[model samples]
Target: MTLRIGVIGTGAIGRDHIRRITNDLTGGEIVAVTDVNAESAKNVVSELHLNAKIYENGHDVIKADDVDAIIVTSWGPTHEEFVLASIAAGKPVFCEKPLATTAEGCKRIVDAEVAHGKQLVQVGFMRRFDKSYRQLKKIFDEGKVGEALVVHCAHRNPTAPGFSGDMAITDSFVHEIDVLRWLLDDDYVSCQVILPRNTRFAENGLQDPHMILLETKKGIRIDTEVFVNCKYGYDIQCQIVGETGIANLPEPQSVLMRSEAKLSTEIYVDWKDRFIDSYDVELQEWIDSTVKGEMNGPSAWDGYVVAVTSDACVEAKHSGGIVAIELPERPAFYDQGNNKVL
Candidate 1:
């Protein structure tokens, strides 16, 4: 049975998901789509040669009877509204990051879904679907690495054009906040941000590289370096230090060439290219699970926790001190997500 999907955004990420579902994956079809710019939605249909109904507003897509499940890839601020509407309509929804602009907004969606008495929302944190991370998770779960003590991570990019302010911590670091919690199966207890020397490449003297220190409840220390102006390439690195041994995230497949007595491997310039396959796998899994009447991905609870974590990070970034992450105890309904960090 093909699940008729409605996409709430026709922007880059939304368009990619539509192409993936229509071309790469199975058990799903793009039936309805809408964006803030109506013409953009029409262009997506025309450009992709999709036979989908274009709507004026996202709510209309959720209201359509043919749309069995909804994908909320619209602007971050509009996520909560469309997700809540999908839940009220008794349809499953796949929401992209931020979940909402604020942690309170994310909690509202969590409360609404809990009230609906079903798991109907899945967040778009694609790192969990990466094969390298999956392998590391399995090794950790099987006790191959003993107990994790310290972790070093790096999130780098060649350049960020319009990025400024605390977006390095708020916008880009949110992905690390969600995925690391899942990788270790632990919740963050505190967070602190260190603004290192600024890079001249940053727009308007923005803080280019920020070092984030996170302490888990179990006293595991994790330091993540967020460098948006590395002037090299998009690079993501995670290495776990354990009692017995250490493990690192495997690098992407690339060819090695020896030229003039020099050897080098290609580095990805765009972030999407680094994890394109993971995104495809993530959405395909979401589609298949939704078809089975299941929501086996990042839950609304995870989204709320990420928002809370992100807020704490932002606070620490400004205060130049550690901020405790005071999160509510996980409700029983969403414990399924915590069990395996799906």
Candidate 2:
């Protein structure tokens, strides 16, 4: 059965998902869409040659009977409302990162889902579906890593035009927050942010390169360097050091060139190019599981935990000290054993 989908938000990521669902994926069809920018949304409908109707607002699209499930890719601050509406409508929703902008908002969605008595939300954290990351996780699970100890990570971007202020932590580093927790299968105990000298290319007073330190409950240490204006290329690296061995994320395959006494390979310029396959796999899994009345990726609870951790990181970034992360007990309703990390 093809699931009729309603997509909210027609921004870059949203439009990309529509293209994936319509062209690259199966078992789903985008029948309706809405975005804050009406003109842009209309243009997308025409540009993509989609036979979807444009709703005046997101709520209208959710209420439409033609939409079986909803996908929320709207602004971060508006996620909570649309997700809650989908729940109230008794439809499964796939929400992009950040279940909400605040921990309290996330908790509300959690409470509503728990009250409704089912799993109806999937948060988008595509790294869990990346093949390289999955391989590293499998090695750790198979005891090849032998009790993981430390992880060194780097997230670099070629350029960020409007990135500034706390967005460095909230917008970009948040992915690491979620993926690292899943990688270690442990919750964070405390977080600290170290801001080094700013890059001259940074705009709007944004801190160019920042280091985040996270300590898991089991004493696993993880450090991530976020460089938004590195001016090189989009690169993500992670190396895990364990007791007896180590594992690292494999680089993207590229044709090696040797010329003029130099050997070089191409690096991705944007995240969409870097993690495109992961996004496809993530969405496919979400659709397949939702059809079976199940959710297979990061849950609303994971989203909430990440939000709490992000808040701590932001606090640490501002105060120049360590901030402790306090999370609530995991409820039985969301428990699915060892698969929780995925």
Per-model C-alpha lDDT, please? Answer: 0.91, 0.91
lDDT of 1 by residue, 69-178 (tens): 99999988899999999999999999999789899999999999999999999999999999988988898878888999999999998998777787887678998999
lDDT of 2 by residue, 273-323 (tens): 999999999999888888877877899999999899999999999899999
Off by over 4 Å in 1: 337-342
Alpha carbon RMSD to native, model 1: 1.4
Q: Compared to the true structure, candidate 2 yields what TM-score? A: 0.98
Span of 10 residues, lowest total lDDT, candidate 1? 333-342
Show pairs that collide, candidate 2: none
Q: How does residue 84 of candidate 2 score in lDDT?
A: 98
TM-score per candidate, chains pooled? 0.97, 0.98
Whole-model alpha-carbon lDDT for candidate 2: 0.91
